[model samples]
Target: MAVQWVLVCHGLVTLLVVVSFLCGQWPIFQGTFIERIHFFLTSGAYDYFLRFVGAVFGSKCSNAVLSVEYYCCDRPNPILQIFYLGILSMTYYFIVKSSFAYIPGYYLSGIHRYTSLLAVAVGILLFLLTSFSDPGTINSANVSQYLSAYPYDNIIYAEKECSTCKIQKPARSKHCSICDRCVARFDHHCGWMNNCIGERNTRYFMAFLLWHFLLCLYGTVAIGLVLAGRLKELRVVYILTVYYGIENSFLGLAPHVAQWLLGSYNTLILIAVFLAIVGMLLAGFFGYHAKLCLTNTTTNETFKWQEYMSWQRKLNEAKASAAALRASISGMSSDRKPLLSKWRAFFQRSPLQDGQIVQNNVYDKGFVHNVVEVIYPLSSRPSFTRPKLKPT
Candidate 1:
């Protein structure tokens, strides 16, 4: 079970690292854990024993206060942040879902797409919340007054680390221990996303989420449609369906979200079709991004590699990129390093390997819902075949 150990270790480490980065409470988790070892060094029980022993030696008593922000992302009210984390805990439930056969056109087996669809709804929420127009539209006088003070439409800076750095919060800044650098507009750094979700790529991230959720949902329905079509030939109940049922299948669709937006019959069908198509496209996107989020897919992955090509290699490709780059230079490189050297390094890493499969795999089993699933490359890949879900 070396493979299992490796997977478990990777999962624990990655999850802890992510949780640490997101929660900023490594000390707490670390300390609270392995308490027996820490007792002699930091625990009160050990201190009492030491003081008792030192009573004969006349050890002096001292008092100090230390406050720790544990598990709550070091925000002003971390307890609230934990509560929010509970709400935002993403599940691959949509993807793990069973098919409902009673419905004529219902879909199944494309959890990856359902995840994309779910992410889209989330992206819209995040984008909209992030979308206020500087509040300058309402007051020109305040805007003009502020122009001399700050003088930029959208300006964000990384506040330098210092004793007072805690108070001098910078715009879109997060202290990343893994990178050991502060990222701007710090969203979560996913092992899946492989990079920090900062100011530069938050939009893409949200978009990825939106696309991923829809993709999973679409594939779910589409797979169901195909499965339904095949099952019709046999005319068997497909016993699993009797329990999973048609009503619960509605969970795959953002029933509330769709209903709120689409009121017309023709419009609803159109919306449904559009959602379905988007979901299909999302399936493709998730197939791509599952490698991405779990492994280090980047913007360069788009337009350059089908998989996770390192930014360095992508940079090198860019230097030689007369043929590789887009019509317009988006200047999307994560590293501002020289492109030629980056290209050389990329070639060195993989001489014949064309695309990448960057980042590590995390196979944590406790809870995974609506997770975008990828088919491991195998001897055979038949598209129309009904698939089996991988064990958690």
Candidate 2:
């Protein structure tokens, strides 16, 4: 019972941390404890650590630490890329060391051994493709092509020039500070890949996400089958029924079976739990990016749209308030106006509700075209080459 409780607690803690780290900034979790934890994990902890180092080790040491942090985080360094590879390799090593012997036991076949290796290799290949691929870097030579390909919506995007690159910036392009280059259709800089996911390599990034999710799921299920094979081969049920005099019913035998598994295969159980958590996270991440791709939106564009909508809403509200105030002043009279019933007023819709601002994504072509564009970026097409500028 104590062992079961420990396992339960471990799982709960892992889930909490993972969810908090990944989704603490989400609207649903805003103003909650999860958001606080997310802030600490993402920014606050590092900030405090820097302050402590400054206090204990003086300014010189603090400056050195800050330099290291800048290079690792603010600059395009391979630290996270290396960490990703390390984690992947280490996880595979641990699984092989602890669970490989049971691959061909009872429920699983020997072919899984090779298949698992192939799956991992394919995942790594996808990672490499995303990491090394050109994310549609807009330079002086290709600037015209990119500019012609993506038109400015005049809402979030406008015709502009990159001050750093000294080239015409296309709509939806952003100058990546870390990479020190302008990327067309910029999504975000992915630390794990040490690369920007943009027009050229978004497909590879999506593939990498989807493949890893499936890989984690496969590892979890295969390990489960191996454990099941062990249980069946040993005939633990038969032993429990005959020698231990336990009932054959599921409810009667479940606790003992769980205890036995927990006692014998705790390590495997832990790995399974870890994989399951990671798999679910990857699934969600992939789904989010998939939606963005379908809508022809980038992560950067989402933030832009949020800010644009907010500003528009505030502007409309201000205008409405001014109009109402002018009308109220002009219609001022000696007689008192009748007050509205509390219930009626509470349920009434605001007159300005219809004026609410909504996101108007001008770049969102139909679903199929948007998906195709991600897969085959505009810059790569022959028609994009030597584009003749024309009146909009």
Candidate 3:
């Protein structure tokens, strides 16, 4: 029972880690002790722990240890790749080694084997493409060119230079501290890919997400079927009779059910559960990216725009209050203004209502064009004269 409890706790912790990493934001724990704990887990505590170990082990040994730690945490590394491949390999190993081969033999007619192989192949291909592809890096040669492509909106983005890169910051571009370079139309730096998901490689990143989700889904369904076949062979009537008999005698059936599940299809069931959880998480991630593509915005821009709009609202409120005060001082009666004029005045004075303070999405060239831009980036487009800037 203690061992079972430990296994359950381990599984829950693993799920929590995976979900927290995938979600990217955790508003529920904001300003809480859990948030601090999460921060320490991700950053401070790990560094401190490594330093402590280094101090104990002597400077020379510490250097080697810290270098390995930095390689895993501070930059893109093969840890995620190894973990992903290891999980897949184990799942396949269990599938082949298990006595329940009905899924591969009768149900799928050996097609499942080929499909699984293809899924893994395609997933790896897309992963490599996303990891290695240039995510529209803004260098000295093309910095000016990329700058010309999107004019300053003057709301969220203004004419500025990256202090790190020593180059002009193009509209929607941000310097990634980890990558140590300015990324054009920068989204967020993805640690999984160990690359920035920006203007150039976002399409490949999206494709990777799609393919990975499919692979997980495939594994889940295949394993689920195999488990079901094993259970069917045990006979549902006997299982149900035992379940009800225990209930009538006031004994819990949970232990019985768990024992049967673990004993009959332990490895396959574990893999299926993990794949289901991962698939669901990947689905959410894919949906988020799809929304970003549709809205013609990056993850960085989305957060920035939200903050900018909040600031704009406060500014507009102050202006409106001052205007009202001046109008009252001038003895302008509110009743004297026509209803339409009053309404117009109210709306025009409120930046939020008028939408005047909202940042112009200069890159949004309609839905179809925006998606095409992601797939075939601006860096690859033929050189042409800079077009006139569109109005907000």
Compute the lDDT for candidate 2. 0.92
> Residue by residue across 1-392, what tens digits does model 1's lDDT show?
45434544555565444344333432555655444334433455655765665565444432211122122222223244344334233322222232223223333344544554565466545433433211111122222222222222131222333232233333324455443444432445543333455434444554655645654465445544544454444443343245435332446434532332233122223333434544555455445555454442333323333333456567656555553454235455444644567667666743224543343322212223212212221111243133445699
> Would you estimate the TM-scores of all the predictions?
0.24, 0.94, 0.75
Point out the higher-scoring one by TM-score: 2 or 3: 2
Candidate-wise lDDT, in order: 0.39, 0.92, 0.76
lDDT of 2 by residue, 1-392 (tens): 78877997988998999999999999999999999999999999999998999999999999999899889889988888899899899989888988898888898999998999999999999999999999999898888788778889999998878899888889999999999999999999999999999999999999999999999999999999988999999999999999999999999999999899988888888888999999999999999999999999999999999888888888889988998898788668546678889999999888579697778898898999999999888888888885586799
Q: What's the candidate order when arranged by decreasing lDDT?
A: 2, 3, 1
Off by over 4 Å in 3: 1-9, 21-24, 28-37, 47-79, 236-258, 314-359, 382-392
Clashes of 2: 0
Best by lDDT: 2
Q: What is the lDDT of residue 335 in candidate 1?
A: 40
Q: Write the per-residue lDDT of candidate 3 for residues 149-231, one digit (tens) a residue.
A: 77788878999988988888999999987788899889998877788899889999999888888888888877766665655
Candidate 1 at 367: error in angstroms?
34
